[model samples]
Target: MNRRNFIQLLGVGAGATILSSTLIGCGGEPHVELFGWSGPAATLKDIRLKVLSYAILAPNPHNKQPWIVKLVGPSSFALYVDPNRLLPATDPYYRQVHIGQGTFLEIASIAASALGYKANIHYFPEGQYGNKALANKPVALLELTEAPNVKPDPLFDHLLNRHSNKRSYDRTSLSPNEEQLLQTFHQKTSDAELVFKSSAQDQTQLTGFLTEAMAIETGNKARDEETIAMFRVNQAEVEKYRDGFGVAQAGMSGVKKIVAETFFLSREKLEKNPAGFGEQAVDITHAAAESTATFAWLTTKSNQRIDQIKIGRDYCRINLQTTAMGLAQHPMSQILQEYDDMLPLQKSFKEGYGIVPNDTVQMLFRLGRAKPTTHSPRRTLDSIISV
Candidate 1:
């Protein structure tokens, strides 16, 4: 089916509950064809879906599995963004959506590699006439090729094992080689930048900036609401939806509960008292910011949608790679994505990196070695794929 028909079907048939069911699978026909010669081995057709299960498990902002997959003749499958799952308010330009799409592509590509196929993906096709939203953008087409017998990227194994480590990181700094390896992920992307802050003083500075940035994000009425909506407050809801940001089961338990409750309470008050709610929002956002280590930004020369997705894919790749090196990544994107709250943080970033306004920053994340944390949940492969 064409993307337009698929989108229309979604609009008419998939309500919220159906959306949820679609993620985990209810009673429905298989959406993808099983065999093809161009993509992966025919034997893999039976198990490629299983391999994609691992990629679906990758973390995305708010557990939004903003991706759609179609097996095109056996050798190739196209991945597209799910417009219904976008965070239009905060991600006005759909930058987060694009990044999330990139993350999904990288996960599938890596998983394909592990399963003995080299997945070749090309971003938005240049010539296509169809639904404007789906047609113009890049489509990550995974074509199976003979896998190279190279040493496994320790990270390939960690794909399932890795999760964003949101808690405090150990004070020990990363070795030069580890840092270089992480940097190498993005060095090839002309429109990106990576800065590693390991010194105590720099770490302290980053922590302070993050604290302040978080405060501003959470304080703003619109931004806070956007974030809160994506948060799956309870473990039950988290498990059922199979997507969302949840407090790691291994981290400080009471902390996630307290934060979730506090936000819930604050959200209630915001409905009744706007002024008071605004002040509280700022306070909470700032407090949340102060809790991190190093800072890094993924910048581009232009702020187009495709570039953002590329930035996102590269970001996920680097983070997963870092996890392999026993390191962690913390996002401090409030400064880059939220204008009002993160102004101070932006100034600091530009000053620190000697960056100019002409250059666009697509992602801002921090890195360190931290204790392992809980992995974010994902929607099932059956939900994302179609024949």
Candidate 2:
């Protein structure tokens, strides 16, 4: 089915049946309120803030917007992580958090280049991370220097257009040229490699793995509760928090949306029906994975903080490229998550991907043609900027 028909079906349960009520809805404000901040930033006299505004649009885990920026000078800012935003249950070691910071930095650099400035980034100016969790160390110090000759990033134009598409994707495969384009796009700072798999066998295997991972996560009370806490059930809660996962992000409408918000998205209801909810979660994830036309991952030789951040930057670039190619991408790295319960899945994932024991798979995602999706709500810049 075409994008329009698919979207209409989503609202009416015509094509794909009601997988999960939480996964159906167009619940919040429509005009991209948080994204609107970019307009003023682009025209603002303060170049640093202008670029930083675009950086805020970068994709982060759960839209946490973990970045904390302090305007230290006319053209520079100090980047820090908000301790409260850490995903202790899913990402106990802050690996994903650091990767998220890297994604922000990459977007900031691209935005700066688009505005005719060269961004100079210094990572971990204070010190490096210890073995387990991230310490009080700052993520980066960004300084922009005016360079009129600097060309804009090709992917920069798609920054606003890019979004994480969570809908069930079309089964049509990407063209050879498109596949080659994704494989060729490279980031120089880090030694991470982008790997793509589009075979039917690979897709089927991945679907099973992802489905199992979802079951594992939803079965565990603590981990499941962490996710449940982040579910913004209605438009009011979505706008209020503007950070957590919500039904509003799903882009549904009409009766289906109303039903989803009232029933499936309710935290209390989910808690009462843990088994049913877990089954729905697995079903939804399985369907999404089965719909994939391609699967891509980023692997690095090391799992150091710098490596984690580097992979995040690469992941951001990949998202932009996918957007430019008129394709949708969704990260499904639950199996690669660094938690005790996830250890076995992680080992299997590494081995399946042919990654060396010393190497780490930093990111994994499904890619395919998909209908247009609504952008997730974001916290305003004021909320994230340090005083």
Candidate 3:
């Protein structure tokens, strides 16, 4: 059967609840296809490919998987931006994209070292694409060399365990010891400072701002439509794309899934009640923010490309540390994005957080204890590699 006919038949033949339960229980073929257990072990024999396999799994904004790779030689590869993956509505200036690339480079370097190689990375070899949309310019050039003396990064072990936990976090504050461990990154690094807001007053204020920001985003017809376009309502779309924002990744289950599939996931329903949907979005964001044990923001001295990349590296380390400490971290950065609608919120956020005019808030997130969450699906290395 043709693709359209198959989808139509599924929609018409099975009732919504029955289909949702079946898909959730059986855990359809798309899940299996998207979640390839092993990485590049059976197909590609090259060590470079093996390293790239782990790199492809790095956390990125919206799970866009925006990095493209080209093998330069036996020991080197060039990283490029996949222009099509750009989220213009959300990330107008591509700051998040650069940060995601930085995360990829950091992971690739760590993987290379773990595999008995030292990775040398040269950023923007073809000249920097500063504060603009990603073009055909190369982001970085990675050269890997065998190093018997180099030790694998301690953070390497947590790569698979680290994920953006979207579940509501426990409200209890962190112990002095846990706080000390998380603060060490700030103490040791000159590139960025980590600011933690755990007081009830601060959390309440931040939550209010976050919910307002989220409401603004949802109320924007263009932004909402863009986000809705990426939502994978069924097992078929989720498995096929293996990317974007999927309902499964949102931690929806059973009755919630059925309701979402029947109402919220339907474009027609959303169009009919965009205002209600926006209100629902606000409520969800408020609940998530209110449950935070702490709200952490990483601030840099400048908003340059190099600083943004450094923020990515620091953010990755922070994520790994969160995983190691048995905690959850979720990025809640809508207020910091660089779109026109976000300008006022950005100014207010900086003032509220005591961030100076010259300084930039590179990342903001809520962190605390939470139930274990599932990892998002990733594309295979073969699909991402250019040559």
Candidate 4:
């Protein structure tokens, strides 16, 4: 269906659903709230749009921007996936999209907490309905809760600052105490398993395997194509249009530039031997693996969608904790994407820890002490939520 029809079906008043709810300050306020009025006096009708504004900023897989919020009442909201945003080729079963929704619920909950409220999330509250529902997937629902303590996460203060740093991380190991702190962050969350390896030799082996994985990733025609598609080649493009799985640095802009320039400067030649481009891609990936201090795998007990979202939220929280502890985290999901040869990868991963096969790896990251990097751009709250 068209965007307009879809909006209408969601009861968003057709074309008017994209409306922005900006909160105006009366006396002296530096920043204007998106939902017009603020303060406790405002009822749910007065603030539903405001609540959704924060939810829109939640991150999604591949920047597919797959979520659309339907404000059901003053204190209730529904989270739906925009099927048009699905990555059928890469995520054939829409598992990633569901995980994205989990991230959405987390964001909504956090945002609500910031506003002195809590969200009561009910996944698939109703039976399947239209394309909004994934194949046999239940409708996800969330209700707002009034709580005494709605204090935002201290880490939430760094939401804008938090980003996935893909650059070469500094070679530094976490101290025993620091390692314990990271472990604590995972221990609180029951859904995920944090696998930490400290041995320099073990890290080196994992790094080498990751390098090989990168080589294989670039060599595969389909995988390379997906990577190329997500590369936002330049600053101007990124600033103007914000949404892509990855951003390419100006000078070392990887296959992204090769692809973009192909359309602009060398379209014909690129259409020939795309495999030749894989060389630099491989090196870049390997460099990413080589320049890190430690390697960790965030695995889930089961491969359920809820578990994936839990993994995302847990990882995001841990990343902030890492930042606060004067460390850096760069996700190395490339190796885990090697679904075919994951046996050896799993074997190697299990060599250090007695992890089981039932546990699915959600994200792989390298952590160390590194200089803080620039923040990546995000979609405006205006473009995100609906009331």
Best by lDDT: 2
Q: Write the per-residue lDDT of candidate 2 for residues 1-387, one digit (tens) a residue.
A: 333443444432312112222211111112223433334332468988778777887788877778888888678898888898878888888888888999999999998898899999998888877747667778799999999999888777787667787777877667778878777766444457877888888888888889988887777777777776676777777778877765445446456656667654666777776676566667767778887878888888778888877778889988988887789898986888877888888788778767787777788898888765656767777788887
Model 1 lDDT tens row, 1-387: 332332222222211111111222211111211111012223444545645665675557666878777777756777777767777556665666677777877777677666667777776655432321444344566666667673344456666445665555445667778777767765854447766766667666666665566565666667656666655556666657766564342243344345443444333544555445445434433333333445567777766656766777788878777766767776656666645456667778678767777777777776666555545566656778766
Ranking 1 against 3 by lDDT, winner: 3
TM-score of 1: 0.73
**Regions of model 3 farther than 4 Å from truth:** 1-37, 40-43, 186-190, 254-259, 262-264, 267-276
Error of 4 at 39 (Å): 17
Candidate 1 regions exceeding 4 Å error are 1-44, 126-138, 146-153, 175-177, 184-191, 254-292, 338-348
| lDDT ranking, best first | 2, 3, 1, 4
Mind giving the per-residue lDDT tens digits that candidate 4 earns over 301-382? Answer: 6776556656666776777577667677777655555246444765665554666756667777788755444334456644
Q: Candidate 3: TM-score? A: 0.86
Candidate 1 global CA lDDT score? 0.58
- Best TM-score among the predictions, by candidate number: 2
Go through the candidates in order and give each one's C-alpha lDDT: 0.58, 0.74, 0.73, 0.57
Comparing 1 and 2 on lDDT, the stronger one: 2
Deviation (Å) of 90 in candidate 3: 1.0
